[model samples]
Target: MLADRIPIADALHGKALELVHEHRAASVPLLERHLSIGPDMAEALLLRIARETTVVRRVQSGLYVYTHGPIGEELAALHGFAQEVLVALASNSVDVDQLRDAAGRYGFSIPHQAAGNATVAVPLCLAQVVNV
Candidate 1:
């Protein structure tokens, strides 16, 4: 089931990055248990995963932590965008003028405020309609 949700390459590599960020350093058995990976494949997967992500540092003789540089920066930027949009939307219904104001304040031009409104509104409407 877990395999179906995420691509194998991402699951192996991305999950390792996530684990290192969360646990700092982990052993083979621990990683296997946490990720539900077989012992036979654990070492190879760990090595492959570690090769892709940034190594923060070695915490122990045989343990290391990993993180992604581009992904981290992208997530931070996305969080900032979401926060600004939510704050603006929370104060009042989002309209073209308000989104334009927000875009200016955020140092960018969202010239397609109407298009963005439709994009956001469709999901909101769907959530209400589906009771999600």
Candidate 2:
């Protein structure tokens, strides 16, 4: 049932949520470190999660940024697996360090720069979400 029930979007979103919890914010380096993925892959995942959840925030230059609020909550819930993780992190309102620790438990290795950055760059996969 688990195999049959798992959706690609759900899995991807879960991964993104885990990275967000670990980084306390979404950034390329954090996502790459946590997921063991490249910056491109991490961006793709973020974009996918954002699109699937219908959570659109303004992009500064090329990076996507979101605050802890209703939109964030809704986006987290869209992925199911990410909902709890996001909620737990958001509730305490911890900083990037705390977020990195949380991600470490899940085997994420974030970068210092990524943790420090506020902007998260999204990948092309997000096009689907934007188009919809």
Candidate 3:
């Protein structure tokens, strides 16, 4: 599985991935039009998608092509599982150590410093999906 190389704000990840998968490509203006965001945010989303995930590849200065297929689908599924782990961490519904071990099995690496404490660890882990 591809590492969560960069943090993609939760608010934008769904719509951004939607556009990429549906259109099989993305550009700054496309995101702005579809998401009603400004140029800066559109650019940020594009950069995050290109850098963080394997589903899309930067093909030009401001354009990315989604590499649609089994591999892309698999990576997307892994991302979904990662999100589930984050939810469990945030809700305090499960033990931190168990969640940590589960996350690692899926290739989601919790920072070493996050060990032991749920309060600190939850935010540290969630920082990957949202700004903290």
Candidate 4:
């Protein structure tokens, strides 16, 4: 029996795509470090993915931003919400109650039991963000 093997370039291309999706961003150094490939090959991989895939877009020199899919969408939404919260807070446009309501809409709520002991929840919230 004979088995088919994918060419090395194809394997690298697939792995590069996976790495970009997993990290939610991509760069030549990221590919080089994660794939253990030379700079030239890492750069070529990034160019190929940028040219061939729609999920990534070059935001600036040597930097690609993931702009689609579940993770990308969630991050984008969170960023927008954060900006809104910042602007509102800086202008004193919203009360604490209104801010809590807005945060609740984004799946965040102030724990009533953690009123003065907020330190205990900080690490847990950070872990959840990092895991996601």
lDDT of each: 0.51, 0.51, 0.65, 0.62
lDDT by residue (107-130, candidate 1, tens digit) is: 443334554542222234422422
- Candidate 2 versus truth, CA RMSD in Å, comes to 18.2
Off by more than 4 A, model 3: 1-8, 60-62, 70-132
Task: Rate residue 63 of model 4 by lDDT.
Answer: 71
Clashing pairs in 4: none
RMSD of each: 13.2, 18.2, 13.2, 11.8
Q: Model 3: per-residue lDDT, tens digit, 1-117?
A: 122344457878778889878887777778889999877777778777777777786664646667678767666656665677668768867555665665566555556544544
Q: What's the TM-score of each model vs. the native?
A: 0.35, 0.40, 0.43, 0.44
Using lDDT as the measure, the top candidate is 3
Task: List residue ranges in candidate 4 displaced over 4 A.
Answer: 1-8, 70-132
Identify the superior model by TM-score, candidate 2 or candidate 3. Answer: 3
Candidate 2 lDDT trough over 10 residues, lowest sum:
123-132
Candidate 3 at residue 26, lDDT? 73
- For residue 65, what is the lDDT in candidate 1? 42
Judge candidate 1 at residue 58 and give its lDDT: 32
Give the alpha carbon lDDT tens digit for every residue of 1-132 in model 4.
010122247988999999988997778789889999877776677667766766776665657777667765565556555665667757867455555555556655457644442211223543243221
Quality of model 2 by C-alpha lDDT: 0.51
Q: Output the TM-score of candidate 2.
A: 0.40
Tens digits of per-residue lDDT for model 2 on 15-98? 777667555576767777776766676676666655554443326575766545765664444334233345655686534444
| Better model by TM-score: candidate 1 vs candidate 3 | 3
lDDT at position 96, candidate 4: 51
